[model samples]
Target: MKEGNGLQIPAGMRDLLPGVACDQRQLESRCTGLFTSWGYQEVITPTLEYLDAITIDTGEEIRDHLFQLFDRQGKILALRPEMTTPIARVVATRLRGAALPLRLCYAANVFRYEEPQAGRQREIAQAGVEMIGAATPLADAEVIALAVEAIKQSGLEDFQISLGQIEIFNGLMEELPLTVEQKSKVRTLVAKKDFVSLEELLNSYGITGAPADRILQLPTLHGGAEVLEQAAWLGVNDRARQGLENLRQVYQALASFGVSDFVALDLGVLRGFDYYTGIVFEGYTVGLGFPICGGGRYDNLLGQLGYPCPATGFALGLDRILLALARTNPPARATSAVYLIGGDDTAAMLNKATQLRSQGLSVEIDVLGRDEASLQAYAQTRGITQVQYCRQGG
Candidate 1:
């Protein structure tokens, strides 16, 4: 039997109480409204998925962070670590022939067995959109535009989306005279932004000349349009060079949407090769070490799942955005319903509540026949603007 820990909840899990819980709901509602306006229909996926499916494309790195259990038949199961893979599976198997360029959005909870921190919840709330079947620069730019708008609409003043293309790194690596294993090690170092160790590692490999120099410089080639221009001149293969060209077009497309101010180039924002194939970006704000939002182009994922399609998407850490908003733009307090005070007229108060509710107002009828003055005081405390007294025989 499970041990009783009544008020003591498990690590990394939390309860969203009255005020903040309401704020979260309001935020989600607002996002849903925004998504609807953008023509992205919402969809809900299962919270539980098979363990093998989750770990397949993502590699074994995620296995340690998964919360797994065995089913009655001994089949392995796990809570969703993320949404993209599950959604990809849905597109592949269930909605195989659905319309192309499906714009699907979701507001849901995902679980990961991670260390609890300020914004890292074991059970996290995420709101995101998947733009599948379109592989053009416009598709990439569209999601970035939506992400920028969502943050701006969320009342966050100071935040930026760091944009980068994975192919640039992959391209530079391909030009190097290193084996696959050696390139993987170098990529890992650059991903962590470990310039010192990366330099030493390059030296250990006896790599000299342009490829080494350009590889070292790739991580630091960030910020503004200069980076893209610099990319055009970087010493790399044609494939990586073509990746930069693609990112340049994306940047130009973003400018047309008038969101260039919210974007910056950071080739260092390496997300990983397992999923994100092309342009990867991260949303960051001052004083927050983690990105509030992240997503990228995955032209290969659907193919891996048996469907051949190009797609781009993003996922916002709703809890992390809430935390940031709390620190900066604190949400408004929740309101209360009209309180009905009863004095031996509970039935009358019920009738009054029904009348008010029918008129599209919230109402709370008294059950214990609380006094008028006391009920009024309670209403005032709960932010209820209106109150009615139902007296007996009146």
Candidate 2:
């Protein structure tokens, strides 16, 4: 292997220049503000947590994706693969004594060791919220509705939320005669929407009849409220029926919130996490093959952390959202920047810059002492429009 220059970043990471950085910051601001307006106080968790703590209920896949390191005491510390687990830990310990249904939000970066591609990265910047101690369809609906609004607030209008209840699938599985390994394989196939393989696997087990039929029909059971009616006609078990009813209540609540237009009933939807006990959803926008945001009701995660409370939340991939926006509406290169070109009087330039900053303007003073031509050239290259000269006397 040949050694290269030091300018190269890791494969999964890239440098975000000024304009892109601005866009990311703006997106974060808009989302955090919306979260605050919805009465969700911002919470910050450490970037790294104990490997055991982070891997609480996360399955083998997520555990394998963790970027782990050993600390001084030889304890394994891993960069958090996601925020929900850490927030659950926080609720279990710090916020344990706090009020019920804690509405907390966060905007931070997470790490996961993966074969990075377009949306999936080694370092992911995300923002999301968690509502602790609430275990109702209304709570699920609330989070789903908020996710819709958050995506809209990010200037993404052409998006849809695929909503599903894991219990529906669990309910269907309850009636099936299969070993634990078989069930795990079925879940993997369903999550992948690999109907062909799923059918073959089920047929090999001699699992026929209504339950098998429903399992096969799960992925196709997506669309409007009528999908629910179709699922009901499938003669599902008690648990499946309960999940359908829960989906109905959530749909009604979303309608009440005026966000039902963005939601669709997806009975086959299953999140990757093992903690989801009820509603799970993923948000997709036009032009993006993968979901830009996802989360669900994890009524059991807090219990795993010893908190024992029902919680629900979602996280939006800031990078993916920006990518979607860029595809739809490319950010303008030109920025509203005012460059204060100073002559001999650096103090006057500083004072003017301060004054403009006080008036909420993005002002920059010429620290390099560039001449008029050079300053204008630099400003033009940087997409800076406004340029003012600060002389010695002024």
Point to the candidate with the largest lDDT: 2
What residue runs in model 2 are displaced by over 4 Å at the alpha carbon?
1-6
The CA root-mean-square deviation of candidate 2, after full C-alpha superposition on the true structure, stands at 1.9
The candidate that wins on TM-score is: 2
Please provide the root mean square deviation of candidate 1 (C-alpha atoms, Å).
Answer: 2.2
Query: Candidate 1 at 374: error in angstroms?
Result: 1.5
Instruction: Enumerate residue pairs that collide in model 1.
Output: none
Alpha-carbon shift of residue 197 in model 2 (angstroms): 0.9
Task: List TM-score per model, in order.
Answer: 0.94, 0.95
Judge candidate 1 against the unseen true structure and give its global Cα lDDT, from 0 to 1.
0.85
Q: Please give the lDDT score at residue 359 for candidate 1.
A: 93
Misplaced by over 4 Å in model 1 are 1-7, 177-182, 338-343
